[model samples]
Target chain A: MVTLEILAISMPISVLLGIALGTARVYGNVIIRGIASAIVITFRGFPVLVTLLLIFFGLSDFGIYVPPFWTAVIGFILCSGSYQSEYVRGAIRSIDIGQSLAARSIGMTKLQEVLYIILPQAVRRAFLGITNELIYLVQYSSLAFVVGVPEMFAVTKTFNSLYFRPVETFTTLAVVYLVMISVLVVFFRGIERRLAIPGIELTTK
Target chain B: MNSNIPVLKVENLKKSYSGRIILDGVNLEVDKGETKVILGPSGVGKSTLLRCINMLTLPDSGKIWLEGVELTNPNTDINKMRQKIGFVFQDFNLFHHLTVLKNVTIGLTKVKKIPEEEAIKIAASALEKVHIPNTLWNKYPAQISGGEKQRVAIARALAMKPSIMLYDEPTSALDPQLVGEVLQVIKELSTAGMTSLIVTHELHFALEVANELLFIYNGKIVEQGPPEEVFANPKHDMVKKYIASIYSRKG
Candidate 1:
């Protein structure tokens, strides 16, 4: 339960971080983009288990005793944020250069242009990628068990150890996770279909 | 009165991209309310010239003055100068996310700070001028035909009510069947005495509508005069070769 709450908090926090980093990767200057890319690649290249251990255990060695739950959440967010940045960057680039030119020609400030014109279009483009990332994140929640936080997956392991009925306990946990992701997939697909630009084909010929 | 102080002037315009000269030492002038057509062969920098005039493409070196405002000067206010000259792109760069009405209204509302009600009213009239029905105002760019989108782009420019309109091959991207409607809309604007600088390949249309014609080649004005005089009499060998090629194609 504690692990689940951490995962839930991590999900939204990381999504927001992903948006920020992704937007920077797409629109920032050379130096800012370089830093953002380094952060994204560094987090994504390493294993989540290693990352969690480093944050929860390694930090304790340095005299910092932060809560294990927040540590897992931080590690998960770093992992998710990197992947999400790629999605946001790809979505923003998919938009036509003409759109930005048209906005600028009309005297819109650069920030105003992005806020009113580019972001709306980029958001619509990024929706599917974000949904896919959500599915991935739900699966990633299982990694929280390595940190000794008793979420759904960790709870099942405890149940298996106590009852010695590992098969039935693991099966139930797997089914619960599968059902949750399936529902999320269906819900996001509906939103994607409804919110997509009308009559505008997403695929380029 | 004082020759009406040419609404636009370009002197010694020079531009190059990666060692290739695009607009090399070009010069021209357009008086207030006169329609000027720039005729050029493909890749001769006609569009680049227009792009530079609007500051859409910065020139390496040049002087561009619009409505007594020095556009090419380092001290000039780009946004302010841009507001006074509405540009119509060849690709009809309408905001794909916006409806025809919203595309037309955005600049007016956002840049000019015009009241929403008044901007909508102006947008409606501008669309009516382009012959796009108010019923189609809510339709997105993807829902409209290329001709309709071009007209919407024109309407978007018109809504700004700038001192001049710059058209870079306004009808070039249209299908053969759809070309006439956009040309017809531009024809109507000519009679309104609006200052217009058009870069186009429609020779007959340029002859019929423009007060003066400029023939550009290799980023310089090779020949220019009243359309009738330039077309009827050959002054330069390059101009003669160009005209002969077009005439032979028709023959």
Candidate 2:
């Protein structure tokens, strides 16, 4: 359940940060956009392993003694958020400019236009991409074992070595990951349906 | 509601895109309870003019006043002022995600801070004024016909209770049969004394609705007078040509 706990916490943080990052890149002034762009490029350019290792060990280099579990969570959020922002940025661009103009015509402020009009439409369009990210998140959480956070894979590895039950222990780990991924997919499917606009084509993949 | 002050006034409006002028020295006045139609060929800056009056497109060098407030002034609280000016676009720009009723009430709730129940009451009356029955109020824009969509757009604007309505080719996007439905609603609203300025190519509809017809050519009001006078004695060659073409098409 530690795996689930990490994912539950990291997922919401990453998604919120992803939205803020994408909006900054799209709507911010030159300096803010530059900062958001630089973060996306840096996090995305390095491997997820590199980020995890850096957070797990490099904090010691700075004399920041964060717990290993929190270090893994921080790493997951930063890396996953960078990837999610790319999808969000693409979705925001796909929405019609007419939506913004219509909102503005009725005297909605610029921020209100983004929050009430543009983001709702963009988030719906970004759902499929976000679901794909959720699937990756299930798998990515397993990487926490490398930081000695004792997630599912780490526990399975220890059990396999102690009991020498490679078949049972590894297979159970595989099934758990499978169940988590399937549940994540179904949950996102429900969200996609609830958020679907009247005219949009709802694909059932 | 003073007699001397026009509901809307534009002075020496000019706009250019990349040095190619669209509206050059355009000027006009719309009095309270008057419907003035600007008849022009497409690309003569009619849409730009309407957008400018709404400040959606800022004029390059000019001034606009709505009910004695100079809109061009930098200190004008644009969002606050915009609530008092209604604008309808050619392609009915309804909030697609919202139902017809919510589309009309959204501005009331979000912008004007009206309570939901009260906003719905205002929306219902506005929708009724535009002839949108309650049955269709819950439907999204995609579920409705084009004429209904345009009417909802009008209702969305009208619910704000603006001093003047600016319609930018309100019926140009409709099918021929559907065009009459939307125009009929506008006619009813105008005849009932809604101050509106319409930019459209529908000469027949213009004659039916407008008290004054302003013929625009190359971004200038080439001829202006009562519809009957402009049709009977068009002063400029451009106006004469435009009226003749419409009459020829009818035959």
Candidate 3:
């Protein structure tokens, strides 16, 4: 129930941050893209354990004492945003150049062209990546225990400590994650198949 | 043809790619309501020349005046100038995701800032002019035939009410049977006195429709006159050789 509560709070924030940053990376100019690149490298290059330890312990030295749940949410949102940015960039770039040209030929301003023509196609292309990231979010929700937030994995650990049966506790947790992820995968695949364009590629991968 | 200050004029046009010239110092003029066809072999810069008319290619050096407005000036509003000049590409270049009606209405609403209902009304008339059925308006480009796609491309351009239409090998991508259908649409436009510059390989269509024909070869206008004089009299050796090559291929 703690993990479920954490996911309910953090998942939407993670997705929203991912989309906002990912969109900027794709449409932003050279300097903006460079900055976004640096942010992504810093977040993704460090191990999640190192990031959590730094956020929880190192930040206290700077007189920045963050609550455990908020700290976990911030860390996960940054990590998820970095991981998903590349997928969005690839999807936005993969759209046919002709679409933009067609929009321009019709007298669309650069802003209008991006908002009306380019973004719609790019969003469709990015849906599969977004779905994959959702699965990663579900799995990564387990990592919130490192910050002492007591998510699903934390619940299993407590159960194991009480019962002295680690195998049974972890086995049940594994089955739960599996069922949840499979349900999400099937649901997304159906949506993708229905919205798929005839000529354009369905996935960048 | 009405010669009212030459609705479209090209002077000393030149285009080059990596030090190789494609349109080398070419000059031409089109009076209002005249259909001028630029005939040439592939790679002779026919498409590039037409592209220059709307600043799409940005000619290396040249001056194009449309309706007395100088296009070569850097200060010129290229978007406004392009809005007045319509272009049909060899590949159709229709938006694959957009419906035929949307494709036509896009320019009207976006460029002209016309109201949506008014734009739709204009697009409908343009589509009707191209003889595309109103039933096909909602279809995507992938669902349409090459001929129908080209017609939509034309309608998209015509929605702007352009003063001159530039066609770059409009029927080249169509099947042999479908080529006639697109050419017929163009022929109707020509008869309606729509000013046009067409770069085409269809010698017979050029002969039948063009008031003036230019035979371009080796990046130069090797022959220019009425189609009958250039195709029949054969003053230039290069022109004769090209006609013979085309005939041999047909045979």
Order of models, best TM-score first: 2, 1, 3
Greater-TM-score candidate between 2 and 3: 2
Give a tens-digit lDDT track for model 2, residues B210-244.
Answer: 99999788888888999999899888998888889
Candidate 2 ranges beyond 4 A from true positions? B1-3
lDDT of 2 by residue, A1-205 (tens): 7888899899999998888898889988999999999989988898888888888788889998778789778888888888888888998998888788778888888888888888877877777887788689779888898888889998999989999999999999899889888887888878888887776565754
DockQ of candidate 2 (2 decimals) = 0.72
**Alpha-carbon local distance difference test for all models:** 0.86, 0.89, 0.83
**Per-structure clash totals for the candidates:** 0, 0, 0
Worst 10 residues of 2 chain B by lDDT: B77-86
Residue lDDT tens for model 3, A43-115: 8898876777789888999999977787787787778778877777787788777676656655566677777
| Positional deviation of residue A131's Cα in model 3 after best superposition, in angstroms | 2.1
Among the numbered candidates, top lDDT falls to 2
**TM-score for each of the candidates:** 0.93, 0.97, 0.87
Q: Order the candidates by lDDT, highest first — what do you get?
A: 2, 1, 3
Between prediction 1 and prediction 2, the one with superior DockQ is 2
How many backbone collisions does model 1 have?
0
